[model samples]
Target: LNPEARAFDASFEVLSVEEAVRVTGRYAPLADAVRELIEATILTEVDGGVVDNARAAIEGVTESLRQRTRSAKVSYRVDGRPLPLGNAAVGVCNPIAPPIVVHQEGGGRCWSEFVLGLAYEGPPGLVHGGVSALVLDHMLGEAASEGLSKARFTGTITVKYLRGTPLGPLRSEAWIERHEGVKVFARGTISDAAGVTVEADGVFIEPAWARDGQ
Candidate 1:
C-alpha cells in the first residue's frame, strides 16, 4: 500500500450505483434539483438521453472555452477567477440554483444568490422542503470537488431545516467541512436576505473511479 496516498480511516457500507442513486432520490426534492441542473447546465440546449452523453457535451464546452480563452494556463479566468466550466455546469444543475446571480468566485469556494421560481415553490410561498435539500446537496457537492477534481459524489447527507427557507432572494455557500481520507464532508446553508433559514451536512465519497485522481 502506498501509505502516503491515504491513511485508512473507516470503511462504509458500499452502495451500488443504482442503490446510491435510489437512496439519494429518497429526498425527492434533491433528485428534482439534480434533474433540473443536468438539463439546464450540463446538457445545455443539446438533448442527450443519458448522463454520460451530457457530461461529454459539458466537457467539450469547457475544453473549448479553456483553449480559446486561457493564456499560458490553458484556462481562462471567468469573471476574474478560474472557472472549472464542466464542474460549475454540473454544480448548477441543482434546481436550487434558480436563475439569479452567482457571486464572483475565489479559490475553491463559491456563492450564489437567486430567487426561487414558481416551479420550485412549496408550502404556499416558501421553497419546497426537498428543494432546500437539493440546493444544499449541490453546493456541498461542488465544495467537495472544488475545481478540476471531480468529487467521488455524495454518500450520505444530514440536513437541519432550521426554519422554513423562503423562496426568493436567498444566498447559499459551500465549503469543505473535513476529509477522512477518501471520504469528504462539506457544510452549507440556505439563507434569506434576512438570515439563515436552513443548514446542511454532506458526506462525499471519493469513489473508486476517482481514487486514481487522488
Candidate 2:
C-alpha cells in the first residue's frame, strides 16, 4: 500500500469477526434494558413517595455501575458488524435512544421503522419537530450510502414538516438522488397511517477511504 492507502488504513480500526460477535452478545440485552428504563422514566407519573424511592434505587444502581466502568467508549459502525448496536444515539444497544430499525433496500435506498413514545412528544399528541428531524437525518444518512460506498456523514439536511407525525409506529425511507465525487444527494420521508408527514433532502459525504478506494 502507498502513502495514500496507508492514510485510510491508519484512520480506521477494524476488529476481528469473532470479537465483534462476542461483544454483541454481551452488550445487546443490557442496552435493551436501558432503553426500556428510559421509556419508563419518560412516561412515569408515580406518586411522590414512589418517585423518591425509585430515585434512591436508581442512585444505588448507578454507583454500583460507576465502580465497574470508567467512561463510555465511542463505537462507530464496523465493516463486518452491520448492526450498530453500540452507537450512542439511536443504537439498538444504547438505552438512551429511539433505536430506529433500518433495512437496506439495495440500489442506494434504505428503509427504517420505529415507534416514538411519550418521551418524544412535542405538541399534545404529536412527535416533536426535532425528533422528526433526528429520525429523518438518520434515515437519509443511511440511504445515501446504501448499496453504494461507505462515506456516510451528513453535510447538511433540510426538512419540511407537512403535518404532525403522530406518536406510534412510523416509517421512514430514503434513496440517493445523485452523487458527485465524495458528496451524495439523498431524499427522505417520514409517514404514518395518514400518509407522508415530513420530507427531507440531505447531502452526505462518503468516508475518506471510500473516496480514494483505499
Please report the candidate that would top lDDT against the real structure.
Answer: 2
All candidates' lDDT scores?
A: 0.62, 0.77
What is the alpha-carbon lDDT of model 1 when measured against the actual structure?
0.62
What value does the lDDT take at residue 130 in candidate 2? 94
What is candidate 1's lDDT per residue for 1-214, written digit by digit as tens?
A: 2221233332223345565456435544553655466546633555447657867876886576466432322222333233322232232323434533344254447677766755677887788888888777777776787742454578999989888876667888878867798988888888897788989888888766456634
Q: Assess candidate 2 and give its TM-score to the true structure.
A: 0.81
Q: Which clashing pairs does model 1 show? A: 37-93
TM-score of 1: 0.53
The C-alpha RMSD in Å for every predicted model, in order, reads: 14.2, 3.7
Q: Given candidate 1, what's the lDDT at residue 141?
A: 70
lDDT string for model 2 (120-203, tens) is: 899988999999998888888788877324657889999999999999999998999998988989999999988999999999
lDDT of 1 at 60: 86
